[model samples]
Target: MAATGLTPSKAGPSRPSAPREAAPAPPGGAFARALRRNLTAHAFLIGAVLCFAVFSWYPMVREFFLAFQTTENGEVSWVGLDNLATVFNDPAFWQAWRNTLLFTVLALLLGFAVPFLVAIVINEFHHAQGYLRLLVYLPVMLPPVASVLLFQYLYDPGYGLLNELLRLLHLPEQQWLQDPDLSMLSIVVASTWMNMGGATLIYLAALQGIPGELYEAAELDGAGLLRKIWHVTIPQTRLVLSLMLLMQVIATMQVFVEPFLLTGGAGPEGSTTTVVYLIYQYAFNFNDYGAAAALGLLLLVLLAGFSAAYVRLSRAQDE
Candidate 1:
């Protein structure tokens, strides 16, 4: 028998394998990821800042400097308060203010009230709401110049649709844009027609947001339409109304286009001459940029003060 050399050897302990090391991260990887994530937002912000700097901030700074400086033949010199003094002393200054105030009042009466009323009326109708909204907003979509021109034709004393309607109804045909007494009113009417669409839509949105349960509760309380509106609707939309009122006042005070196109920047007997029109006159017609800037500074100050006060009051009310 062959003895097999198969003696079992004593087994030694096996060595453990070495642990693998992770790959190192790329340099600045976190920073690159963050930059890429916000790149679009940063781009939009930068563009907005640049636009404001160029068109708003730069112009404002230039206007402030120009207000205190005068230009003569090509040379510029500081004039302290002379430009402001000149603006104050101008004969047309008070008249322009008076006209602007009047326009503001008239615009508020028509522009503010009409849109709210229109919104209310439209909101009451459940059917054809889209059609009504589109019809109301059509004028807003039109070019401002075209709308003004259309109104201009409608205001012509002869051969105008409005006057023709008056004739048909045996009413006196009015000189809508020619007569001093009626010129401002006519302008207000046209402005209301052209601009009320936006306000109406805003009011409509606010109205729609009001809870239907409130109206139902009012109805249960034996409230009529007017009572329901006064109690439920008005209270619900008060904030919107306040905001729109402030905006309306600011916008009306700065009105230029309506009066400008309607009455050639000044109505009969300078009736429709607004502060903005006066500013235009100073800068362009009379070539008095200093006075224009001074006047603009005054307006800016006034509007800023008014806005600040309004915001403070609103905050107080909220509190």
Candidate 2:
């Protein structure tokens, strides 16, 4: 055979391609990946923490210090327990506490019960629920001062709506805020009107969350409306009720705006004076920040103890 110009090609053993390096894993492995993934969430959380520290925590810390310290002629000095003694010896101290307790009782009677009743009634209706909710929440959206002033108008003895209604009903119109006997009650009524909206809505939400089957079972057991509420509704929403009761007590104990606006903080014969109002008098009217802070510390301790006890009781009940 004639020799060809190209020789037959020989196939050598195949060489494997170099394994690709895994792009060096970016950097700090899993931790870096997680940081990048949650960076936005961490940013928001940090902002919230900073805000709480600046506003809430800082004031509490400052209040604690101010409770034990006094300032005179621009000089600050530690006055261990003197402020507390001053508050204790003040005649208004016991009276203020009494009035505050009275207010809380009155508030619980009206503010606590009324909202739940209102919620129950509103929930019973099959129509106009949205309108009812809006109506209930309308007062909440109004400026609190405006609401208080409106109630003041309604409470006026001479030309107030309440007195006019009394006249129409052939009843003698009595002094509402001016009389010491009726002053606290009047304040409580006004406070309830102004603040019940939020609580009513919360109650409505809780009521709606209840399972309908429970009510059906109650009905099958021949339970009346009251019975159903007692057996089914109350039990189902007990947690919410307890929580709201505690919050109501806390809030009512700290009340200031309504009485301050309605009856000038002390009312007739100091009948409407409250602990918070006394604190205000100490701090602003009397320029005794130390005494005010001391009173505030006492209130804080009381509320803290109450809250702890309440939580313990709730846990016991749950268990």
Best by TM-score: 2
Give each model's whole-structure lDDT.
0.93, 0.94
Query: How accurate locally is residue 20 in candidate 2, as Cα lDDT from 0 to 100?
Result: 88
Candidate 1 local lDDT, residue 104: 89
**Tens-digit per-residue lDDT, 1-319, candidate 2:** 8665654455565689999877766678898898899999989999999999999999999999999999999999999999999999999999999999999999999999999999999999979999999999898899988998898888899999999999999999989999999999999988898889999999999999999999999899999999999998899899999999999999999999998999999999999999999999999999999999999999999999999999999999899
Q: Candidate 2 — number of clashing residue pairs?
A: 0
TM-score of each: 0.90, 0.92
Off by over 4 Å in 1: 1-33
- The worst-scoring run of ten residues by lDDT in candidate 1 lies at 2-11
